[model samples]
Target: MPFPIKVCAVCSEEFELKPDKPGFANRCPECSIPESTGDSSTKQRMDADERKNASEANAARRQAMRELLYRKDS
Candidate 1:
């Protein structure tokens, strides 16, 4: 019995289902030409959102660390 797999819509790369693999991505995780697939703006927005989330999280962590160090000195 062959485990069913399909070509990625983003990069047309074939992939098989492997539950053991990390993330278990069914498609190519790195598709450089997002614009050619007719979703450049969406991809860009997604990228921006991810960057913003990461930046916000990092800022929060830094603030927490600053507070902790300040309290230790008090």
Candidate 2:
């Protein structure tokens, strides 16, 4: 089956919407390519650290909520 035709959100060009297309469904492949920013490894590591910190914070928030909901009356 032929891929569906989609208009690019950025350049306003028509492109084939394939299953392996990167970035967003609304954006064309050319527009989907991410601009390089120095070392990718370092950036990935920083992103991982940020995700870890965010996950920890979320866990703490859930724990606080659980405590508040399950705490016994004094």
Which candidate tops lDDT? 2
Off by over 4 Å in 1: 1-46, 72-74
Q: Compute the lDDT of residue 5 as modeled in candidate 2.
A: 99
TM-score of each: 0.35, 0.51
Runs off by more than 4 Å, candidate 2: 37-66
| Model 2 Cα lDDT, one tens digit per residue, 1-74 | 99999999999999999997779999999999887756567544548889899999999999999999999999
lDDT of each: 0.66, 0.90
Worst 10 residues of 2 by lDDT: 37-46
43-71: candidate 1 lDDT, tens digit per residue: 54548889899999999999999998787
Question: Which pairs clash inside model 2?
Answer: none
Candidate 2 Cα deviation (angstroms), residue 5: 0.7
